[model samples]
Target: MKNIVNKTFELFSELEHCNNDQQKWKIEEMDGIMREMSEDELNSVLSARMLNKICQMIEEKKMSMENAILLLKCIGYCTMLKRIRVYCFNDSLVNKRFKTLIVDEYKKKEKKNEKLLVDFCECYISLSIYFPSGLLSVCVPCLQKVAFQKEENEEAQNEVEMALMALSNVKNSEVKKELSLNEITDIIEYHQEHHNLTHLAYQSAWQFLIFRFNMERSLEEVIVNELHFVREAARELEELRECVDWKRREKKKGEKEMKEVLIIGRWLDVIVHFFLSCQLWNEEFFGLIGGIESAFQKAKGEHRGICKECISSFTNIERNRAVTIEDLLKGRAVDAVVKEFQTQTLNNEMTYECLTFLMRVLRRLKEEKDEMGEEKINTIKKKLFEKMEEEGHEDIAISFYEILHFFKRRYDNGLSLDISDYFVNVRENG
Candidate 1:
């Protein structure tokens, strides 16, 4: 069995020489060996010998770019290679050798193929590397390459997908271990640098790490760090979106490039959503709402039009729903966010979206009537109505009146005349 495995490695080496005859014969021999060895033995032989040979060729500079990539594919397709990747990543010598191979390949390429080279580089960095030192500088060029590359080769694409999956699994395991915020940050930074991964990737990786480590880092720490990461990522994505190449891609596919940008944008949205919802749930992370809101405000200011629109919409929906929940317990009104939402009007098509926000806020206020007290609630309602009137939201005013009437009938009896008259008058005047 050992001899047969040796022969198989020898055959693979010969295939590198472009000798078709030898390749065929070697494959035939490999087939017979596979038939003889049990699954365990096959795995052992592949990990011990076959994988080592591939690494050796890379170390010896005997592997071609094409062959090295093909070898990666072969390994990826093999069940044993998955385990081997984990083991090899843990090994300093093996990991260094892999990095060297990828860097060398990148250096040999001309400018025209640089993007392709960078994809390979990202793949190399993403596979086994982890935190502050994983691949930050390395990822920049690789990201540039991904942006530059007009099309993706199968291996490059597959490698990225696989890398994400592996990181996700690692994160899950780390969460069980209960790692610290700094530790989670390290993992995120590592993935960001090496894989040139997006914020979502970082978030996913962090979530998994938290689960894997089973650490008890405060939710505040988690949210703050995540928001910081997202903010930076969003800025970078915005710049990338402005690039001529990226714009060209956008024109070609409308939102294809935008979708890629959204990879980061969506994570930012999640952080905002989580923080606001946390406020209502009375989660410890609620404290970060101020910071999160500031971040969103800055983001909205810096990026007007579509980017601002999407994020603002997200904030509106989250804040409205958050304020309504009874169990989550609302804090002091975020006058700034409310003012911002009111100031940003939508077209007729977006009226419903706007209505949704108003409805959520009203519903929450009604549900928590006892906690908020009649006097404070009425003050808030009056303020909201005045703001709506100022903004010419007659429709909103009318809807509020209807809602007030319903509540007045159900809870306050006919004594809710003030609310009913205000809305009814607004409807009539409009």
Candidate 2:
């Protein structure tokens, strides 16, 4: 690690004296060093002083397109580390300097720098994860300008995709400030009318838009009551069903089918994200339960996990009037979660969601003294305990015990379960 630190400083010194052509190579060399860094090495390098040095270099150097991308890739990688995320969150200059760089590059009227724009989007998305509030207020407008600008070129399409993804990462406060209702309406209509963008691009745009409606309380009524949005969701569900059927029938998906599955998975994500924030669930919307279940059953890998996570959300709806434990049970929520635990290796997020759903169910059932719920609880307990015995899951086991302890004490005291008690552990992945 000391050797790695020395090498990094050496590259920085070389960058200072290097010519533009040589600078590119130096940055590339820097990228390689950062790429090979261990977690501790990354943490070491991502200090305030190092960030200041990086900002100075970015300001001083007339970096080539490739060099700028290389530098940003290194920065992007650092932003992904858990410790570095905490560091970035506490540091305001990192956000401001990078946002200015992205905006300045964006405002340049020469031929568009497509790779730089995408990297800017990627880096900004990473920053937004830690600085969710005001970080994107200025940057998002620039992304929106390019994202909504009509251009029928490959460069335009890729930038639009990245920009939409960046917008999706914007916080609710910034989202409300940056995006207007008319602009939001335009995005929905524009994507519906245009097919020039790839499925991923359109899905990202939708994800961004839905996230806005979900986060901004003012738009909740618009999303829930809007007939057009419901129609679009219905249409997307039909397409999702077709994809689910294809996955069921095909033994080995070719490249095209794999792409199609991924696209469909993104759409599933959009729908789930939308409903996850819905304040109420009407009958017509709830009728789509069958489709959600079928997709969960047939979809593979992460997509299937996404479906299960979505189904898990059904039981825990905080504001929805029509969502009952009985409704969730009938929709086969318990069965889907149980099957997942029995058959699949659950990720942290999925494990938490599934456990949250069951805990809620058990709490409700215990209050009502429902015998069937008792049977279901016994089955889920068996599966979870069996899972606890596996290796590399000490964190999960700890969470399991915490949840059990919470319930035992709550039941003894005749107190209701508070979901907030366990909410902090959801980001345990970090």
Candidate 3:
């Protein structure tokens, strides 16, 4: 077994100078060796030697970029070899192996051997063209080292570009396969760790997963799932914000980090708006919104100068366009709020902001007024006030008063006022 392993290494070593005819001979020899070796023997030998062999060919300048790519493709297709290859190349546990190999190679060379390092980096990048999924796993650390060296090697930069292109193509292919949510999460986690230096790819992967998930379910359903991710992202933002705040006591670096936190906060706000627009109100959901609002309020109080105006504009637009409890009860929207308290709480808001939104929705409903029974409207109004008192928001009482007054003045003078008051009394009695 040892003899066969040594002979295999020798053949790999000779690949650098091997011509087309020699390459054919080497291929045949490798095939014959495979025919004789047990599966276990083959696995052991390949696992121990394949990366070293590839690196040797690279160092010797015998491996063409094209052939390096072909070899990885071949390894990918080899059913018996696929697991080992993925283990070595894609598994995060083996990251240290690639890192060690690159660092050891660098240590063996003189300072002026920068060209050799650049060539090896280029070759490593080429390997990604064949196994793009694994490329980010294996090559990113090495690329980061190169980037850190601050060497102005255009070839090295192009190699990173090419690897990214290949990764993009692989992602497109994966998306078309209708991968499950778990699979998408796995891909995201992998890229998140491996491509930390290039945030665009990670962000793109996240957005793609979200977009695809949204296509299969209503926005309401998507919002429920999004809650989990949103909370996780928000926690990270809070940590980042703390870090920035601490840094602000010393330097200006905090500003850039704060911008990242703000961006994440804005995304969370957008997600909240989506949930609110569907009238999918729940205690937990409201708690999340209240938490964000509180954070924004604190930031504003601290004079942190967050984009409050923009957030207000977005929140108002969402509320005005949002489906109301009445719309849900009438079965007039995609998502229906079925809970009695939820429906009531949604309607009793009286803040200038809330009133403005309510007026807009009420105007639209009146314009499209299909004769809903006065009794049903009264029942809904009663439920709303009862829930408001139950929820301890007495401010809603005044809002209801103003809404009733508006209806009287706008429609039939005093005629509508009596009908509206009748429902209000029924609500109070109930």
Instruction: Give the per-residue lDDT of model 3 (tens digit) for 1-430.
Output: 4566567667766777787567656755765554344335556655535765665565576775446544533333231211122344443322333445445556674554544444444334323223343333433343333433222356544343333322322222223322334444554554444543233223323443444443444434543454354444344445434544532432243434544443444444344344434444432433334344444434432322342332333234335334344532342111111111122432332122333333443343444335555566556556554544554434443435546665445443332332232222343333
- lDDT by residue for model 1 (1-430), tens: 3476666566666754654454445555555544444335545555434555656766665665455554443443233222233344435444565566556655574554654555455444444434223333344334432332223466554444444433433322222222234444554555545555543344444333334322343554444454344344345444434432332423254333433444434344444444443422323233333333334444444434333544344435355443333212232123333444454443322233334434555555666669878766676666666655665556544544445544444443332334332231212221
Candidate 3 segments exceeding 4 Å error: 1-183, 188-205, 218-227, 240-253, 269-283, 301-427
Q: On TM-score, who's better, 1 or 3?
A: 1
Best by lDDT: 2
RMSD of each: 16.4, 10.3, 21.6
The C-alpha local distance difference test score for the whole of candidate 2 amounts to: 0.56
Better of 2 and 3 by TM-score: 2
Q: Candidate 1 or 2, higher lDDT? A: 2
User: Residue 231 in model 2: shift from native, Å?
Assistant: 6.4
Backbone clashes in model 2? 0
Where does model 2 exceed 4 Å of error?
1-53, 59-66, 73-93, 99-126, 129-137, 175-178, 214-218, 225-273, 287-295, 298-319, 324-331, 341-355, 362-430
TM-score of 3: 0.33
Poorest stretch of ten by lDDT in candidate 3: 332-341
